[model samples]
Target: MTLHRFKTCATSFLAPFILAGVLAGVLAGLSACSGNEGANYEYDYPTVSSDKFQRQRLEELEGGDETVFGELSIGGPKKRGGAAAGEGFATVNYYLWRATLETLSLGPLESADPFGGVIITDWFTLEEEPGSQYRVTAYILGRQLRTDNIKIALYVRPKGTGKAKMDPHRASAVAEAKLENVILSKARTIRATQFK
Candidate 1:
């Protein structure tokens, strides 16, 4: 083929590819700009308490005293319930701790598997009130709550020197291997009978 004809054909074919590349570059630029705007969107959630409980939770987590095995922390429950059918109503106490991903080498918990990010908690105080700030800790459940992006579920149990007992089922949520109950409350407590 003559040089002129060959050149014409190549230019025509390359035009579309070049145009596509330019279009893609423009789209990527716009996409990045849009994402930056996302940072400007404010989030609204209940304000995290500045109380000692919250402070202690962050302090222990940041102090590097513990490590999470997967998606767990060793503390007490964040949610509470009334007494069970057979058991009398009891007031549950909780203490929380926090840790950073770089420190614990843990990842996001909500992604299919939470236990992947675990932190072994240290004994912190659960203040039921004056003289009642008992020492305790446990495995915590971690999930990226949209606002803070890092939230851990405290699975509390009886700690050193504390006679107060947590429902067996609540304890199992942390101890069991297979996920028997996604909702922590629904799982049958190991029951006082199992302990005996």
Candidate 2:
């Protein structure tokens, strides 16, 4: 009974303030909604003349008619097939370099030079050719992902021999050519995946 009496007295004392707050809120909302949108209004800032740089920028923005990155011209898209801003121009073939590294992963990597496009592998023997340990040195000659721009040299050391030379039987010139072909195939695959 005491709690009920306290709640009733408190609500009665706060009723006038709550009603005034609700009345103020309703009036504010009605006034806001009754804006004079029919009244004409204009920006008061003075117009400024465009300089040469401003005109050039406006022209560039307006002249984006080329369809790029498979997107509409109105929206910005990635520029294809070139170095982006702040990046140095690429001189070596990227796909060829990646493909050579991937194909030579059979052996332990000794050295890899991306700019110079040189890949070398340490002497390692495959399971099929346990008697012959092989080393690979690949050179990407140009900025093209073509077969002629890439070169591969394979050296084989037979079991019990201290020095290593081009393989006589296992990894000969034929094997070198085959290695180049493998790298080329991998490059093509990598290029395909990138496009997709």
Reference-based lDDT, each prediction: 0.36, 0.71
Q: Give the Å shift of residue 40 in candidate 2.
A: 23
Taking all chains together, each candidate's TM-score versus the true structure is 0.20, 0.51
* Clash statistics: count for each candidate: 25, 0
Residue-wise C-alpha lDDT for candidate 2, range 86-144, written one tens digit per residue: 13322456677778888999999999876566889998889997887888999887655
Model 1, range 12-123, lDDT digits (tens) per residue?
Answer: 9999999999999999998887676536666898756679777886554343223223213333222323433113212111111222322222222322222333333332
- For model 2, what is the alpha-carbon lDDT of residue 13? 100
TM for candidate 2 is 0.51
